[model samples]
Target: MTVIDAVRGDLAEVRAEVDATLDRFLAGKAGTAPDPCLPPLVEVLRGFVAGGKRLRPLFCHCGFLAAGGSPDDRAVVWTGAALEMFHTFALVHDDIMDRSAMRRGRPTVHRLLAEHFAGSREDDGVAAERFGMNLAILVGDMCFAWTDELLDRVEVDPPRWREVRALLHTMRTELIAGQYLDLGGDPRSTADPVRSAWRMTRLKTARYTVDLPLRIGAALAGGDAALMRACGAYGRPVGEAFQLRDDLLGVFGDPGVTGKPDLDDLRAGKPTVLMALARQQATPEQREVISALHGDPDLDEERAERLRDVVVATGAAERVERLITIRAERALSALRSSSMAPAAKASLSDLVAHATRRAR
Candidate 1:
């Protein structure tokens, strides 16, 4: 098989292994739940986690192998599964904050919970919505706790474990801080929207999604500072490219393929680099249109299309495409220069392509 094919096969196997680990872990939690009602929450988490690409776990596994750790090590798998659990927690909270109705082509956790509780309330819609948000918040907190529980079970020497714990803590803090920025904190209020967007992307996605996972895995395998630094060099740029591609897909991708409404980002006024660029480069007339149409709760398809046209006409989309290429190249360069295992290098190279160029 080609290197890319081999990497794909290995990633599929890792995904299955991580899924099995998560299934077994959650089953145990469900079986031992303090309250019978908690089992359903575990069930919801299980369902929500089942449909992801499992990219974080795959990257962690690659990092482990890159640092000379055994591919068959169960500790590596457990750590990777912990990362996935943390990701689920983040997504659940994100959906609530965004007021997103759909995730993974179904009602979001909050929406699903709201609908489930609808029958018990006199003011069914309003009360159910409140119930859903509250319960979903608790569910997200549970997932966060479970992630730490899973990580705690992984066997490593004391120093390595300490390093791993530090990385994990840093990752969580960076993600939460990034989310705050995304939710219109001080960073979002900056005059230079593009710079603010990039800063948020680095904190929210680059470190959390790629850099920390790789470094954490490497640390677990006792990799030194230099190797961990190399991982950051490679991972951060690729991670940024991944998020940039996601921003593009949010605005321009087919809903059937993306499993998300294309209009959601526009309506939510997400401060993406693409939008920032469009705003910066727009003509006065286009800016007026953006001001009137963007973030409108009742924004229709026609106006969204016009907004899209403005983005495209301003060349922001093409500029983002160029940026993706630049970052992917930077990642590839780092991979080539590093002394990681050849197989790991090949897998990471494939990952850069997959992460940056995917349609969904």
Candidate 2:
């Protein structure tokens, strides 16, 4: 089976249920809104939420199952919905910060908002864009607020709920700190960019995206410390591999398949491990190309292609491919050796492939 195919059917089941739960919750939210104007925003949110791969929630469910929680438990599903809401908050805000114009093959939330404002009001272009940014921020804040609402509805044990909350809090803090470091560019001449980039990857994606989500699910099931430790074993390497592959994809993936503009990561000069590796291995001429064009805000497709060549020439892409392989192997080894049930271990093993190799 294809690597992603392993997770496809099983994950689809979790996805459908979680999607239904979110739909019902958001519909209820819209129906009970304090103001007429609020319903429209919720509709927009539903649209935005619909297109996600739901990887976090799937991992959450997997953790629940891994901890011997019953698949029939509504709490796990509801809590997964809550995590999805939180993810929406992150993505919306992330797009704003990235100045991304497209998401999930559609106009980004903030950009859509800007166009809406521009169409409705006789405002200058800058005013409409500013309005869009402000409104999108509010929308992200609302998603954060709704996460509490979703979690409130889930009836887990008090002690377990506390643990889950702690995990979520840590995830958010790490994500924000990582994002701040991300926004602070790593100049080509930085003393130790590879180390910085790896730290950022672990904080922003590894712990936040995988480790905590798995632990959160396990927590809801009252999993013991041993189970939590096992989840970390499978989670950390897989999450880092996931981000490292994503870094490669960002620079080298087809925009048509990935549904993201290829230029953004390069244009932003994201100090990803992939980039740091390239900077380290580059010849002086190749280093010159990266320095002059890597972070240019107005970088075009052709220049982006040239940078891709530099990465390949420096062997950074091949080295990153090796990194992904090692991490995936470590994650799977952890899964195989963990005390988690065989069925759960199998599913997580599948995830190693999906997280590390997905096109989008």
**RMSD from true fold, candidate 1:** 2.2
TM-score of each: 0.97, 0.96
Q: Candidate 1: minimum summed lDDT over ten consecutive residues — where?
A: 1-10
Q: How accurate locally, in lDDT, is each candidate?
A: 0.88, 0.88
- Predicted structure 2, TM vs. truth: 0.96
Which runs in model 1 stand beyond 4 Å of their true positions? 1-7
| Tens digit of per-residue lDDT, candidate 1, span 36-124 | 99998888878888887777888898889899999999999999999999999999999999999888777899998888777867775
* Candidate 2 Cα misplacement greater than 4 A, ranges: 1-8, 185-189
Q: 1-360 in candidate 2: lDDT tens per residue?
A: 223445747777888899999999899989999999888788888888988877788889889989999888999999899999999999999999999988887888999889866888888999999899988999999999999889998898789999999998898888898887788653542678898899889998998788999999999998999999999998999889989988998999887877788999988889899999999999999999999998899999888888899999999999999999999999998888899976678788888887887777
Whole-structure CA lDDT of model 2: 0.88
